[model samples]
Target chain A: MRLSNLADYAVVTMSAAARHCGGGRTSAAELAAETGLPVPTVQKVVSKLSAAGLLRSVRGAGGGLQLARPAAAITLADIVEAVEGPIALTACIDGDECAVDHTCSVKPHWPAVNAALRGALAGIPLTQLSKAAPREPNPSGISA
Target chain B: MRLSNLADYAVVTMSAAARHCGGGRTSAAELAAETGLPVPTVQKVVSKLSAAGLLRSVRGAGGGLQLARPAAAITLADIVEAVEGPIALTACIDGDECAVDHTCSVKPHWPAVNAALRGALAGIPLTQLSKAAPREPNPSGISA
Candidate 1:
Protein backbone atom coordinates (compact mmCIF):
# COMPACT_ATOMS: atom_id res chain seq x y z
CA MET A 1 0.00 0.00 0.00
CA ARG A 2 2.90 2.33 0.67
CA LEU A 3 6.55 2.47 -0.21
CA SER A 4 8.58 2.61 2.95
CA ASN A 5 10.33 5.99 3.33
CA LEU A 6 13.59 4.08 3.18
CA ALA A 7 13.00 3.30 -0.49
CA ASP A 8 12.22 6.92 -1.33
CA TYR A 9 15.33 8.10 0.46
CA ALA A 10 17.42 5.49 -1.36
CA VAL A 11 16.45 6.92 -4.75
CA VAL A 12 17.03 10.50 -3.67
CA THR A 13 20.30 9.69 -1.98
CA MET A 14 21.46 7.64 -4.96
CA SER A 15 20.64 10.50 -7.32
CA ALA A 16 22.86 12.74 -5.24
CA ALA A 17 25.62 10.20 -5.55
CA ALA A 18 25.15 10.01 -9.33
CA ARG A 19 25.65 13.77 -9.61
CA HIS A 20 29.02 13.40 -7.92
CA CYS A 21 29.87 10.03 -9.52
CA GLY A 22 33.19 11.02 -11.04
CA GLY A 23 34.19 13.33 -8.19
CA GLY A 24 35.57 10.38 -6.20
CA ARG A 25 33.91 9.20 -2.96
CA THR A 26 31.30 11.62 -1.56
CA SER A 27 30.62 11.83 2.16
CA ALA A 28 27.20 11.08 3.60
CA ALA A 29 27.15 14.55 5.17
CA GLU A 30 27.88 16.07 1.79
CA LEU A 31 25.12 14.01 0.16
CA ALA A 32 22.68 15.01 2.89
CA ALA A 33 23.37 18.69 2.26
CA GLU A 34 23.23 18.29 -1.52
CA THR A 35 19.90 16.49 -1.42
CA GLY A 36 18.48 18.33 1.59
CA LEU A 37 18.14 15.03 3.45
CA PRO A 38 18.46 14.76 7.21
CA VAL A 39 21.99 13.75 8.26
CA PRO A 40 21.02 10.67 10.29
CA THR A 41 18.60 9.45 7.64
CA VAL A 42 21.12 9.96 4.87
CA GLN A 43 23.69 7.97 6.85
CA LYS A 44 21.16 5.19 7.38
CA VAL A 45 20.40 5.16 3.69
CA VAL A 46 24.11 5.00 2.92
CA SER A 47 24.63 2.08 5.29
CA LYS A 48 21.70 0.15 3.82
CA LEU A 49 22.74 0.78 0.25
CA SER A 50 26.28 -0.20 1.14
CA ALA A 51 25.14 -3.40 2.78
CA ALA A 52 22.87 -4.20 -0.17
CA GLY A 53 25.83 -3.85 -2.52
CA LEU A 54 24.08 -1.07 -4.35
CA LEU A 55 26.80 1.16 -3.00
CA ARG A 56 30.41 0.66 -1.98
CA SER A 57 31.98 2.69 0.83
CA VAL A 58 35.46 4.07 1.43
CA ARG A 59 37.04 4.80 4.80
CA GLY A 60 39.03 7.66 6.42
CA ALA A 61 39.48 11.08 4.81
CA GLY A 62 38.31 11.55 1.17
CA GLY A 63 35.96 8.62 1.91
CA GLY A 64 32.26 8.23 1.14
CA LEU A 65 29.93 6.15 -1.07
CA GLN A 66 29.33 5.55 -4.76
CA LEU A 67 27.03 3.35 -6.83
CA ALA A 68 28.20 -0.25 -7.01
CA ARG A 69 26.74 -0.55 -10.50
CA PRO A 70 25.98 1.83 -13.30
CA ALA A 71 22.71 3.72 -12.77
CA ALA A 72 21.25 2.28 -15.99
CA ALA A 73 21.67 -1.26 -14.71
CA ILE A 74 19.90 -0.67 -11.39
CA THR A 75 16.12 -0.67 -11.17
CA LEU A 76 13.57 0.74 -8.76
CA ALA A 77 12.68 -2.82 -7.82
CA ASP A 78 16.26 -3.25 -6.65
CA ILE A 79 15.90 -0.21 -4.41
CA VAL A 80 12.63 -1.58 -3.05
CA GLU A 81 14.17 -4.96 -2.35
CA ALA A 82 17.11 -3.28 -0.69
CA VAL A 83 14.75 -1.50 1.67
CA GLU A 84 12.24 -4.34 2.00
CA GLY A 85 12.44 -8.01 1.08
CA PRO A 86 11.00 -10.20 -1.66
CA ILE A 87 7.66 -8.85 -2.81
CA ALA A 88 4.99 -11.12 -1.40
CA LEU A 89 1.69 -9.69 -2.46
CA THR A 90 -0.13 -12.27 -0.41
CA ALA A 91 1.00 -14.94 2.05
CA CYS A 92 -0.20 -17.77 -0.13
CA ILE A 93 1.45 -16.41 -3.24
CA ASP A 94 4.59 -18.36 -2.39
CA GLY A 95 2.55 -21.53 -1.70
CA ASP A 96 3.54 -21.35 1.95
CA GLU A 97 1.88 -24.25 3.70
CA CYS A 98 -0.89 -22.60 5.65
CA ALA A 99 -4.24 -24.23 6.46
CA VAL A 100 -6.01 -22.64 3.51
CA ASP A 101 -3.06 -22.42 1.17
CA HIS A 102 -4.18 -24.89 -1.45
CA THR A 103 -7.88 -24.55 -0.81
CA CYS A 104 -8.31 -20.96 -1.84
CA SER A 105 -8.49 -20.84 -5.63
CA VAL A 106 -7.69 -17.17 -5.68
CA LYS A 107 -4.31 -17.64 -4.00
CA PRO A 108 -2.69 -19.09 -7.12
CA HIS A 109 -3.28 -15.90 -9.02
CA TRP A 110 -1.40 -13.76 -6.54
CA PRO A 111 2.01 -14.91 -7.68
CA ALA A 112 1.18 -13.65 -11.13
CA VAL A 113 0.11 -10.32 -9.68
CA ASN A 114 3.27 -10.08 -7.64
CA ALA A 115 5.34 -10.85 -10.74
CA ALA A 116 3.51 -8.21 -12.77
CA LEU A 117 4.19 -5.69 -10.04
CA ARG A 118 7.83 -6.64 -9.74
CA GLY A 119 8.25 -6.49 -13.50
CA ALA A 120 6.73 -3.04 -13.61
CA LEU A 121 9.02 -1.82 -10.87
CA ALA A 122 12.08 -3.36 -12.48
CA GLY A 123 11.16 -1.86 -15.83
CA ILE A 124 12.37 1.51 -14.60
CA PRO A 125 16.17 1.81 -14.72
CA LEU A 126 17.85 4.11 -12.22
CA THR A 127 19.36 6.08 -15.11
CA GLN A 128 15.81 7.40 -15.49
CA LEU A 129 16.10 8.80 -11.97
CA SER A 130 18.92 11.11 -12.94
CA LYS A 131 17.41 12.15 -16.29
CA ALA A 132 15.47 14.99 -14.77
CA ALA A 133 17.82 16.71 -12.36
CA PRO A 134 16.15 18.51 -9.48
CA ARG A 135 15.44 22.07 -10.51
CA GLU A 136 15.50 25.25 -8.46
CA PRO A 137 12.24 26.99 -7.70
CA ASN A 138 10.97 29.88 -9.82
CA PRO A 139 10.61 33.36 -8.33
CA SER A 140 6.94 32.74 -7.55
CA GLY A 141 7.94 30.02 -5.05
CA ILE A 142 6.89 27.16 -7.37
CA SER A 143 8.94 24.27 -8.70
CA ALA A 144 10.21 25.19 -12.17
CA MET B 1 4.05 -6.02 -0.08
CA ARG B 2 1.30 -8.25 1.27
CA LEU B 3 -2.36 -8.69 0.78
CA SER B 4 -4.08 -8.20 4.13
CA ASN B 5 -5.66 -11.35 5.55
CA LEU B 6 -9.00 -9.61 5.19
CA ALA B 7 -8.53 -9.56 1.42
CA ASP B 8 -7.50 -13.19 1.45
CA TYR B 9 -10.59 -14.14 3.39
CA ALA B 10 -12.78 -12.09 1.08
CA VAL B 11 -11.39 -13.82 -2.00
CA VAL B 12 -11.81 -17.23 -0.41
CA THR B 13 -15.32 -16.51 0.79
CA MET B 14 -16.31 -15.04 -2.58
CA SER B 15 -14.97 -18.08 -4.41
CA ALA B 16 -17.16 -20.27 -2.23
CA ALA B 17 -20.13 -18.07 -3.02
CA ALA B 18 -19.38 -18.54 -6.72
CA ARG B 19 -19.16 -22.30 -6.26
CA HIS B 20 -22.81 -22.33 -5.30
CA CYS B 21 -23.88 -19.54 -7.60
CA GLY B 22 -27.08 -21.26 -8.81
CA GLY B 23 -27.68 -23.24 -5.64
CA GLY B 24 -29.23 -20.27 -3.88
CA ARG B 25 -27.62 -18.13 -1.13
CA THR B 26 -25.04 -19.54 1.30
CA SER B 27 -24.68 -18.56 4.93
CA ALA B 28 -21.41 -17.20 6.32
CA ALA B 29 -21.12 -20.34 8.41
CA GLU B 30 -21.37 -22.54 5.33
CA LEU B 31 -18.71 -20.53 3.56
CA ALA B 32 -16.42 -20.65 6.59
CA ALA B 33 -16.63 -24.45 6.67
CA GLU B 34 -16.19 -24.79 2.93
CA THR B 35 -13.16 -22.53 2.84
CA GLY B 36 -11.70 -23.22 6.32
CA LEU B 37 -11.94 -19.56 7.29
CA PRO B 38 -12.74 -18.39 10.82
CA VAL B 39 -16.45 -17.77 11.40
CA PRO B 40 -16.14 -14.13 12.42
CA THR B 41 -13.69 -13.49 9.60
CA VAL B 42 -16.18 -14.81 7.08
CA GLN B 43 -18.86 -12.61 8.58
CA LYS B 44 -16.64 -9.57 8.29
CA VAL B 45 -15.81 -10.40 4.67
CA VAL B 46 -19.51 -10.65 3.92
CA SER B 47 -20.06 -7.22 5.40
CA LYS B 48 -17.20 -5.60 3.51
CA LEU B 49 -18.19 -7.19 0.21
CA SER B 50 -21.80 -6.18 0.70
CA ALA B 51 -20.83 -2.61 1.54
CA ALA B 52 -18.74 -2.51 -1.60
CA GLY B 53 -21.72 -3.59 -3.69
CA LEU B 54 -19.98 -6.81 -4.67
CA LEU B 55 -22.27 -9.06 -2.65
CA ARG B 56 -25.99 -8.96 -1.97
CA SER B 57 -26.65 -9.96 1.63
CA VAL B 58 -29.95 -10.87 3.21
CA ARG B 59 -30.71 -11.40 6.89
CA GLY B 60 -32.85 -13.91 8.85
CA ALA B 61 -33.33 -17.66 8.31
CA GLY B 62 -32.61 -19.07 4.81
CA GLY B 63 -30.98 -15.72 3.93
CA GLY B 64 -27.33 -15.09 3.09
CA LEU B 65 -25.29 -13.72 0.18
CA GLN B 66 -25.03 -13.78 -3.62
CA LEU B 67 -22.84 -11.94 -6.08
CA ALA B 68 -24.24 -8.51 -6.87
CA ARG B 69 -22.95 -8.77 -10.41
CA PRO B 70 -22.24 -11.59 -12.79
CA ALA B 71 -18.92 -13.34 -12.19
CA ALA B 72 -17.78 -12.45 -15.70
CA ALA B 73 -17.83 -8.76 -14.87
CA ILE B 74 -15.87 -8.99 -11.62
CA THR B 75 -12.09 -8.83 -11.50
CA LEU B 76 -9.63 -9.63 -8.75
CA ALA B 77 -8.85 -5.94 -8.75
CA ASP B 78 -12.39 -5.22 -7.52
CA ILE B 79 -12.14 -7.65 -4.62
CA VAL B 80 -8.67 -6.33 -3.81
CA GLU B 81 -9.89 -2.75 -3.78
CA ALA B 82 -12.92 -3.69 -1.71
CA VAL B 83 -10.75 -5.11 1.02
CA GLU B 84 -7.55 -3.06 0.66
CA GLY B 85 -8.66 0.31 -0.76
CA PRO B 86 -6.68 0.71 -4.01
CA ILE B 87 -3.95 -1.65 -5.23
CA ALA B 88 -0.92 0.67 -4.92
CA LEU B 89 2.49 -1.01 -4.84
CA THR B 90 3.72 2.16 -3.12
CA ALA B 91 2.16 5.24 -1.53
CA CYS B 92 3.80 7.43 -4.15
CA ILE B 93 1.73 5.58 -6.77
CA ASP B 94 -1.36 6.66 -4.87
CA GLY B 95 -0.30 10.33 -5.07
CA ASP B 96 0.13 10.73 -1.31
CA GLU B 97 2.82 13.34 -0.75
CA CYS B 98 5.20 13.42 2.18
CA ALA B 99 8.07 15.62 3.39
CA VAL B 100 10.50 14.53 0.65
CA ASP B 101 7.88 14.39 -2.09
CA HIS B 102 9.27 17.26 -4.12
CA THR B 103 12.89 16.11 -4.10
CA CYS B 104 12.56 12.68 -5.73
CA SER B 105 13.00 12.54 -9.51
CA VAL B 106 11.53 9.04 -9.91
CA LYS B 107 8.13 9.68 -8.38
CA PRO B 108 6.49 10.52 -11.68
CA HIS B 109 7.28 7.14 -13.21
CA TRP B 110 5.84 5.19 -10.26
CA PRO B 111 2.30 6.03 -11.36
CA ALA B 112 3.02 4.47 -14.73
CA VAL B 113 4.21 1.36 -13.00
CA ASN B 114 1.10 1.43 -10.88
CA ALA B 115 -0.98 1.62 -14.04
CA ALA B 116 0.84 -1.37 -15.54
CA LEU B 117 0.27 -3.34 -12.35
CA ARG B 118 -3.39 -2.35 -12.34
CA GLY B 119 -3.63 -3.45 -15.94
CA ALA B 120 -2.21 -6.86 -15.05
CA LEU B 121 -4.58 -7.34 -12.12
CA ALA B 122 -7.58 -6.17 -14.13
CA GLY B 123 -6.75 -8.72 -16.81
CA ILE B 124 -7.78 -11.48 -14.45
CA PRO B 125 -11.54 -11.77 -14.30
CA LEU B 126 -13.19 -13.55 -11.36
CA THR B 127 -14.97 -15.84 -13.79
CA GLN B 128 -11.52 -17.12 -14.66
CA LEU B 129 -10.95 -17.62 -10.96
CA SER B 130 -13.95 -19.96 -10.79
CA LYS B 131 -13.22 -21.80 -14.01
CA ALA B 132 -9.58 -22.28 -13.05
CA ALA B 133 -10.33 -23.36 -9.49
CA PRO B 134 -7.44 -25.28 -8.01
CA ARG B 135 -8.06 -28.98 -7.99
CA GLU B 136 -7.93 -31.01 -4.79
CA PRO B 137 -4.76 -33.02 -4.24
CA ASN B 138 -4.64 -36.77 -4.69
CA PRO B 139 -3.62 -39.20 -1.92
CA SER B 140 -0.24 -39.67 -3.67
CA GLY B 141 0.88 -36.41 -2.06
CA ILE B 142 1.01 -34.66 -5.40
CA SER B 143 -0.83 -31.48 -6.34
CA ALA B 144 -3.41 -32.25 -9.02
Candidate 2:
Protein backbone atom coordinates (compact mmCIF):
# COMPACT_ATOMS: atom_id res chain seq x y z
CA MET A 1 0.00 0.00 0.00
CA ARG A 2 2.92 2.35 -0.60
CA LEU A 3 2.43 5.51 -2.54
CA SER A 4 3.79 5.57 -6.07
CA ASN A 5 7.09 7.47 -6.43
CA LEU A 6 5.33 10.23 -8.31
CA ALA A 7 2.69 10.56 -5.64
CA ASP A 8 5.35 10.67 -2.91
CA TYR A 9 7.28 13.30 -4.78
CA ALA A 10 4.13 15.30 -5.23
CA VAL A 11 3.64 15.41 -1.47
CA VAL A 12 7.21 16.57 -0.89
CA THR A 13 6.88 19.16 -3.63
CA MET A 14 3.64 20.44 -2.23
CA SER A 15 5.13 20.72 1.26
CA ALA A 16 8.01 22.73 -0.14
CA ALA A 17 5.54 24.90 -1.98
CA ALA A 18 3.47 25.34 1.18
CA ARG A 19 6.55 26.47 3.08
CA HIS A 20 7.27 29.10 0.42
CA CYS A 21 3.63 30.24 0.18
CA GLY A 22 3.64 33.44 2.27
CA GLY A 23 6.90 34.89 1.06
CA GLY A 24 6.40 34.70 -2.71
CA ARG A 25 5.70 32.36 -5.58
CA THR A 26 8.20 29.52 -6.12
CA SER A 27 9.22 28.02 -9.46
CA ALA A 28 9.32 24.35 -10.37
CA ALA A 29 13.12 24.39 -10.47
CA GLU A 30 13.24 25.84 -6.98
CA LEU A 31 10.80 23.20 -5.77
CA ALA A 32 12.91 20.49 -7.38
CA ALA A 33 16.03 21.80 -5.66
CA GLU A 34 14.28 22.16 -2.31
CA THR A 35 12.78 18.70 -2.45
CA GLY A 36 15.81 17.06 -4.09
CA LEU A 37 13.60 15.80 -6.90
CA PRO A 38 14.50 15.94 -10.56
CA VAL A 39 13.57 19.03 -12.63
CA PRO A 40 11.39 17.11 -15.11
CA THR A 41 9.59 15.28 -12.37
CA VAL A 42 8.81 18.47 -10.47
CA GLN A 43 7.64 20.13 -13.70
CA LYS A 44 5.37 17.22 -14.45
CA VAL A 45 3.94 17.28 -10.94
CA VAL A 46 3.50 21.05 -11.11
CA SER A 47 1.61 20.74 -14.38
CA LYS A 48 -0.79 18.14 -13.02
CA LEU A 49 -1.28 20.04 -9.76
CA SER A 50 -2.06 23.20 -11.73
CA ALA A 51 -4.58 21.32 -13.88
CA ALA A 52 -6.20 19.87 -10.73
CA GLY A 53 -6.70 23.41 -9.37
CA LEU A 54 -4.34 22.86 -6.45
CA LEU A 55 -1.89 25.43 -7.83
CA ARG A 56 -2.04 28.67 -9.78
CA SER A 57 0.74 30.02 -11.99
CA VAL A 58 1.67 33.60 -12.63
CA ARG A 59 3.53 34.90 -15.67
CA GLY A 60 6.24 37.56 -16.26
CA ALA A 61 8.86 38.95 -13.83
CA GLY A 62 8.80 37.77 -10.18
CA GLY A 63 5.99 35.44 -11.20
CA GLY A 64 5.86 31.73 -10.56
CA LEU A 65 3.55 29.22 -8.85
CA GLN A 66 1.57 29.35 -5.61
CA LEU A 67 -1.10 27.29 -3.94
CA ALA A 68 -4.45 27.82 -5.61
CA ARG A 69 -5.93 28.37 -2.20
CA PRO A 70 -4.67 28.52 1.37
CA ALA A 71 -2.59 25.56 2.59
CA ALA A 72 -5.17 24.89 5.26
CA ALA A 73 -7.77 24.38 2.54
CA ILE A 74 -5.71 21.69 0.78
CA THR A 75 -5.41 18.13 1.98
CA LEU A 76 -3.07 15.22 1.27
CA ALA A 77 -5.95 13.67 -0.61
CA ASP A 78 -5.98 16.61 -3.00
CA ILE A 79 -2.22 16.38 -3.69
CA VAL A 80 -2.43 12.62 -4.20
CA GLU A 81 -5.42 12.91 -6.50
CA ALA A 82 -3.66 15.59 -8.46
CA VAL A 83 -0.81 13.22 -9.37
CA GLU A 84 -2.83 10.05 -9.41
CA GLY A 85 -6.51 10.01 -10.35
CA PRO A 86 -9.42 9.35 -8.00
CA ILE A 87 -8.21 7.22 -5.05
CA ALA A 88 -9.78 3.93 -6.10
CA LEU A 89 -7.95 1.06 -4.38
CA THR A 90 -8.77 -1.53 -6.99
CA ALA A 91 -8.89 -1.61 -10.77
CA CYS A 92 -12.26 -3.36 -10.50
CA ILE A 93 -13.63 -0.04 -9.29
CA ASP A 94 -13.49 1.22 -12.88
CA GLY A 95 -13.75 -1.87 -15.10
CA ASP A 96 -14.35 -5.63 -15.15
CA GLU A 97 -10.65 -6.25 -14.89
CA CYS A 98 -11.08 -8.93 -12.32
CA ALA A 99 -12.05 -12.30 -13.78
CA VAL A 100 -14.82 -12.90 -11.22
CA ASP A 101 -16.17 -9.38 -11.39
CA HIS A 102 -19.60 -10.68 -12.34
CA THR A 103 -19.97 -12.56 -9.04
CA CYS A 104 -17.41 -10.84 -6.85
CA SER A 105 -19.19 -9.71 -3.67
CA VAL A 106 -16.43 -7.38 -2.52
CA LYS A 107 -16.89 -5.31 -5.66
CA PRO A 108 -20.07 -3.74 -4.37
CA HIS A 109 -18.55 -2.35 -1.18
CA TRP A 110 -15.39 -0.84 -2.68
CA PRO A 111 -16.88 2.62 -3.02
CA ALA A 112 -17.57 2.85 0.69
CA VAL A 113 -14.13 1.47 1.50
CA ASN A 114 -12.53 3.91 -0.91
CA ALA A 115 -14.44 6.75 0.68
CA ALA A 116 -13.18 5.72 4.09
CA LEU A 117 -9.57 5.66 2.92
CA ARG A 118 -9.95 8.98 1.14
CA GLY A 119 -11.48 10.47 4.24
CA ALA A 120 -8.32 9.54 6.16
CA LEU A 121 -6.16 11.40 3.71
CA ALA A 122 -8.60 14.31 3.55
CA GLY A 123 -8.27 14.80 7.29
CA ILE A 124 -4.66 15.92 6.90
CA PRO A 125 -4.39 19.53 5.75
CA LEU A 126 -1.29 20.75 3.90
CA THR A 127 -0.72 23.27 6.69
CA GLN A 128 0.16 20.37 8.96
CA LEU A 129 2.84 19.12 6.58
CA SER A 130 4.86 22.34 6.79
CA LYS A 131 5.11 22.36 10.55
CA ALA A 132 8.34 20.76 11.82
CA ALA A 133 8.38 18.01 14.36
CA PRO A 134 9.53 18.95 17.86
CA ARG A 135 13.27 18.42 18.23
CA GLU A 136 14.41 15.50 20.33
CA PRO A 137 16.67 15.77 23.40
CA ASN A 138 20.36 15.55 22.51
CA PRO A 139 22.07 13.12 24.82
CA SER A 140 25.43 14.03 23.27
CA GLY A 141 24.70 17.74 23.73
CA ILE A 142 25.80 18.25 20.15
CA SER A 143 23.82 19.98 17.36
CA ALA A 144 20.76 17.95 16.34
CA MET B 1 -3.44 4.31 -4.02
CA ARG B 2 -4.39 1.05 -5.71
CA LEU B 3 -3.62 -2.27 -4.08
CA SER B 4 -0.86 -4.34 -5.62
CA ASN B 5 -2.03 -7.14 -7.91
CA LEU B 6 -1.04 -9.72 -5.33
CA ALA B 7 -2.87 -7.82 -2.58
CA ASP B 8 -5.99 -7.52 -4.72
CA TYR B 9 -5.83 -11.20 -5.59
CA ALA B 10 -5.35 -11.99 -1.92
CA VAL B 11 -8.67 -10.33 -1.05
CA VAL B 12 -10.47 -12.16 -3.85
CA THR B 13 -8.90 -15.41 -2.80
CA MET B 14 -9.86 -14.86 0.85
CA SER B 15 -13.45 -13.97 -0.07
CA ALA B 16 -13.76 -17.19 -2.04
CA ALA B 17 -12.31 -19.12 0.88
CA ALA B 18 -14.81 -17.49 3.26
CA ARG B 19 -17.70 -18.59 1.02
CA HIS B 20 -16.59 -22.21 1.26
CA CYS B 21 -16.21 -22.21 5.05
CA GLY B 22 -19.38 -24.08 6.07
CA GLY B 23 -19.32 -26.47 3.14
CA GLY B 24 -15.87 -27.98 3.68
CA ARG B 25 -12.18 -27.22 3.49
CA THR B 26 -11.14 -25.87 0.09
CA SER B 27 -7.98 -26.41 -1.92
CA ALA B 28 -5.83 -23.86 -3.70
CA ALA B 29 -7.04 -25.16 -7.05
CA GLU B 30 -10.65 -24.81 -5.98
CA LEU B 31 -10.00 -21.27 -4.81
CA ALA B 32 -8.26 -20.49 -8.11
CA ALA B 33 -11.23 -21.75 -10.11
CA GLU B 34 -13.74 -19.97 -7.89
CA THR B 35 -11.91 -16.63 -7.98
CA GLY B 36 -10.88 -16.96 -11.66
CA LEU B 37 -7.24 -16.67 -10.65
CA PRO B 38 -4.46 -18.87 -12.00
CA VAL B 39 -3.25 -21.90 -10.02
CA PRO B 40 0.27 -20.63 -9.30
CA THR B 41 -1.05 -17.23 -8.22
CA VAL B 42 -3.48 -18.84 -5.83
CA GLN B 43 -0.70 -21.03 -4.49
CA LYS B 44 1.49 -18.00 -3.96
CA VAL B 45 -1.29 -16.12 -2.19
CA VAL B 46 -2.18 -19.17 -0.11
CA SER B 47 1.38 -19.55 1.13
CA LYS B 48 1.54 -15.92 2.22
CA LEU B 49 -1.87 -16.03 3.91
CA SER B 50 -0.89 -19.18 5.70
CA ALA B 51 2.38 -17.64 6.81
CA ALA B 52 0.46 -14.65 8.16
CA GLY B 53 -1.78 -17.06 10.13
CA LEU B 54 -4.84 -16.04 8.17
CA LEU B 55 -5.27 -19.52 6.69
CA ARG B 56 -4.46 -23.00 7.93
CA SER B 57 -3.67 -26.02 5.76
CA VAL B 58 -4.73 -29.51 6.71
CA ARG B 59 -3.23 -32.80 5.53
CA GLY B 60 -4.44 -36.29 4.48
CA ALA B 61 -7.79 -37.40 3.06
CA GLY B 62 -10.48 -34.69 2.75
CA GLY B 63 -8.03 -32.24 4.32
CA GLY B 64 -7.24 -28.97 2.58
CA LEU B 65 -7.27 -25.27 3.49
CA GLN B 66 -9.53 -23.29 5.80
CA LEU B 67 -9.49 -19.98 7.55
CA ALA B 68 -7.35 -20.07 10.69
CA ARG B 69 -10.06 -18.01 12.35
CA PRO B 70 -13.63 -17.08 11.54
CA ALA B 71 -14.17 -14.83 8.54
CA ALA B 72 -15.64 -12.18 10.79
CA ALA B 73 -12.41 -12.18 12.76
CA ILE B 74 -10.32 -11.35 9.70
CA THR B 75 -9.94 -7.85 8.34
CA LEU B 76 -8.74 -6.37 5.04
CA ALA B 77 -5.73 -4.90 6.84
CA ASP B 78 -4.56 -8.38 7.79
CA ILE B 79 -4.74 -9.62 4.22
CA VAL B 80 -2.97 -6.58 2.79
CA GLU B 81 -0.19 -6.62 5.37
CA ALA B 82 0.31 -10.33 4.73
CA VAL B 83 1.35 -9.62 1.17
CA GLU B 84 2.65 -6.03 1.24
CA GLY B 85 4.39 -5.81 4.62
CA PRO B 86 3.45 -2.79 6.76
CA ILE B 87 1.00 -0.36 5.14
CA ALA B 88 3.39 2.59 5.20
CA LEU B 89 2.37 4.95 2.39
CA THR B 90 5.82 6.44 1.91
CA ALA B 91 9.34 5.02 1.83
CA CYS B 92 10.41 7.51 4.46
CA ILE B 93 8.56 5.46 7.03
CA ASP B 94 11.38 2.96 7.21
CA GLY B 95 14.62 4.39 5.83
CA ASP B 96 15.94 7.83 4.99
CA GLU B 97 14.91 7.29 1.38
CA CYS B 98 13.42 10.71 0.88
CA ALA B 99 16.00 13.45 0.29
CA VAL B 100 14.27 15.96 2.59
CA ASP B 101 13.93 13.55 5.52
CA HIS B 102 16.51 15.38 7.64
CA THR B 103 14.33 18.42 8.18
CA CYS B 104 11.02 17.37 6.66
CA SER B 105 8.04 18.47 8.76
CA VAL B 106 5.62 15.91 7.36
CA LYS B 107 7.84 13.02 8.42
CA PRO B 108 6.64 13.16 12.02
CA HIS B 109 2.96 12.81 11.09
CA TRP B 110 3.13 9.89 8.64
CA PRO B 111 2.77 7.35 11.42
CA ALA B 112 -0.57 8.82 12.46
CA VAL B 113 -1.75 9.03 8.88
CA ASN B 114 -0.72 5.43 8.30
CA ALA B 115 -2.53 4.31 11.43
CA ALA B 116 -5.68 6.11 10.30
CA LEU B 117 -5.51 4.43 6.90
CA ARG B 118 -4.95 1.03 8.48
CA GLY B 119 -7.87 1.59 10.83
CA ALA B 120 -10.16 2.15 7.85
CA LEU B 121 -9.11 -1.09 6.18
CA ALA B 122 -9.31 -2.90 9.52
CA GLY B 123 -12.92 -1.85 9.88
CA ILE B 124 -13.92 -4.20 7.03
CA PRO B 125 -14.20 -7.85 7.92
CA LEU B 126 -13.73 -10.76 5.53
CA THR B 127 -17.36 -11.70 6.13
CA GLN B 128 -18.40 -8.49 4.47
CA LEU B 129 -16.41 -9.37 1.38
CA SER B 130 -18.23 -12.68 0.95
CA LYS B 131 -21.70 -11.16 1.03
CA ALA B 132 -23.18 -9.93 -2.24
CA ALA B 133 -24.67 -6.50 -2.60
CA PRO B 134 -28.45 -6.20 -2.76
CA ARG B 135 -29.74 -6.69 -6.28
CA GLU B 136 -30.96 -3.67 -8.17
CA PRO B 137 -34.56 -2.97 -9.12
CA ASN B 138 -35.84 -4.61 -12.27
CA PRO B 139 -37.55 -2.06 -14.50
CA SER B 140 -39.11 -4.79 -16.64
CA GLY B 141 -39.98 -6.84 -13.54
CA ILE B 142 -37.83 -9.63 -14.91
CA SER B 143 -35.41 -11.85 -12.97
CA ALA B 144 -32.44 -9.88 -11.58
Highest lDDT scorer: 2
TM-score versus the correct structure, for each prediction: 0.83, 0.87
Give the clash count for each candidate.
0, 0
Candidate 1 whole-model C-alpha lDDT, 0 to 1: 0.75
Docking quality category of candidate 2 according to DockQ thresholds: acceptable
Residue range A1-144, candidate 1, lDDT tens digits: 455778778878887788777777789999888777799999998888888899999988877778899888889888877877677666554556656534667765666666777877888877777877423333242211
Docking class of 1: acceptable
> Clashing pairs in model 2?
none
Clashing pairs in 1: none
Q: Once model 1 is optimally superposed onto the true structure by TM-score, how far is the C-alpha of residue B35 displaced, in angstroms?
A: 1.5
lDDT minimum window of 10 residues, candidate 1 chain A: A135-144
Candidate 2 residue lDDT tens string, A96-137: 467554377777667777777888899899988887762333
